[model samples]
Target: MAFLTNVNPALAAYLNEADPTLWSRVYCPGDRYNIKTSNIAESINSMLMKAKGYTITYLIEFITKKLGRWYWKRREDALSLITTFSRGVEFLLALREHYADMMTVERIDGWRFYARGGQRDCLVDLEAKSCSCGVFDVEKMPCSHAIKAVKSSGWHMSTVVEAYYRKDYVYASYAATIIPNVEHDPIGPNIRCIPPIPKQKPGRQKKYRWLTWLELSRKNGSKPRKSHKQYMLVQNADSLDILNLIV
Candidate 1:
């Protein structure tokens, strides 16, 4: 904050106004389950980069086939998992356990302890499932400090981790199949469909879509507007009228 104030006081002030929980993992009230990135949509867009020039029908078919393959492969992997936790979580816990072995735990109480090791010291609370280092609180998994504390308290590592990291939960996540639609003949007589005429705007074409006001507000570090459900209902009504006219 001192560095921010020195460089850009206005930006620092803006950040101070915003809720830290929304951006800072340390302050987050809920578990992230160790999923760090929030740009899954951008990742999907990157995956579809090659299909950008394809027709809408072909593009959809490509996406469906890709998703179907992913679902099948992931379901097989999930089913093959013999461990209680998912493979990734199991690996993570193992790494943490290795570091935890070096840590010395001092019992503060039945459910609390102070862990000191490798130039780092942290307070661990087994009852609250948290540590001063914040990893256990946000990820819902035992950090090295918490792991040391757990071992000292005669508790299993599995008991410290959240159920979300369990193999069963991971399997359930990929259980849904993405079946592609079968090709079918049109119900009505065949008719030639012409493409709509394109009107070129009097400027350089935009490479990206314009951000919505909500998105803009978030990007600009401003307060977001409340959602307009009534406005959305009116828009839906208008769309229904258009569909009725087409019918």
Candidate 2:
């Protein structure tokens, strides 16, 4: 039960006849608050976790390449229009609005991804930063539900980001890899000696006196009776046949 304000004139005008719940559901705090749906994003995280050991190198490079292709396409489209006809900034700027594309993913209830209303559920009460599933944790960019939560809570995205992840934490991993310079002797570094290897012992130790005598007896004897179950398990028919056929 949260209050809905006509925050934006454009949005308020568009929702003139829409369900107040629909608006809430479509946005945050409300969407995350909804007790009724499944959080689908959890499955994606599970899959990712199962696939485990994913290096950040692959993740960062792959996303950058994808975004780069998108930038190139946008630049190409802009250039194509510019070459097609004479246009000024006023016309170009107006056309820019039409040229831009918006992409969105609608959420499903009862899925792995969780939240409240149609908006992203921010459990400020629980310090959920984003969702429990970590989509917010990795992307840093909030999803629709998160955006909705921030707006409804009257908070800024920066605040939400700060609450969950520190500004310094983003480069924390990279910083660990940085090696600082330490003054060193210019001469070839003195080497440390390896610990001496232990001397090898005799093939048979006194502890196996009976075994040693038995082996000697068998070697001296004309033939020896053998009954070993464990060794037999490793002896296949082909191996047995070879012994019989060749021996």
Candidate 3:
């Protein structure tokens, strides 16, 4: 909040107004897997950069084709997997087990245990499927502490992991087909498409993006040094004299 206040007062006010659970991974319930960015949307936008400047009809067609190809390929791959859980979940569980190996577990009761890993100590309850680390509840997966407790009690990891990460569930998630609209709006009475109205603003539109304080700082720190000769050549290049310019 202090950081936002110093940089952007509006952003600080907006953050204060919005629920913390939406932004903070620790407070956010469900299988977030610790993601905290719009990189996935950004990646898709980058992939469709060319289509962005196209007409709406062409853009829709481009996206439709891309999605259709992606769905079919993923559907085939999902059907081929015979594992009990998805590969990603299995990998995570394996990693948790590796970390859990170093942790010491003490049984408290039938389903409760105290797990100590390095400087951290977490209460693990198998019956309630929870951990003091808050990872189990947030990720809907057994944390390293929970894994240590579960293994010490002679229980299989599968028994503790969420069923949502099962192979069948993962397969079912991508089973839906993306059906394309074969035809546009019917010409006469059924015309549903509307043309966009041209509304140009008075001033020159902004081409550069507004960077946050953190982004600006990162840019400054990681910025590459430019060649002085190249920079001078580009700056001094004559716009009208085309023939004399270096090819």
Candidate whose TM-score is highest: 1
lDDT for position 145 in model 3: 95
lDDT for each of the candidates? 0.83, 0.42, 0.80
Query: Compared with the true structure, what per-residue lDDT tens digits does model 1 show for residues 69-163?
Result: 99899889988988999888889999999999998999998889999995579999999998988788878899999998988888888898998
Native RMSD of candidate 1 (Å): 21.4
What TM-score does each of the candidates earn?
A: 0.66, 0.23, 0.61
| Model 1's TM-score against the true structure | 0.66
Task: State which candidate, 1 or 2, has the greater TM-score.
Answer: 1
Model 2 clash number:
32
Candidate 1 Cα deviation (angstroms), residue 117: 2.1
lDDT score for residue 62 of model 1: 69
Measured by C-alpha RMSD in angstroms, how accurate is candidate 3?
14.4
**Model 2 agreement with the true structure over 1-247: per-residue lDDT tens digits:** 2123345666565666666555554343322432433555665455445223444444434444454555565445444552222233224323422322121223442222323543334332213555543445434435444544444445554554432233233223223232222353222213322366998797965554456555766878844456546534436888888777865
Model 2 CA deviation exceeding 4 Å by range: 1-144, 152-154, 163-166, 172-193, 197-247
> Which lDDT tens digits does candidate 3 get at residues 1-247?
7887999999899887899788877766545565547988898999798676556676777788789888898778778887778888888888988999999999999999999985589998999899898888777789999999988889887788888888778778778888877777512323334568989899988798898766776778965344345433444446435535654
Give the residue spans of candidate 3 off by over 4 A. 1-22, 29-33, 181-247
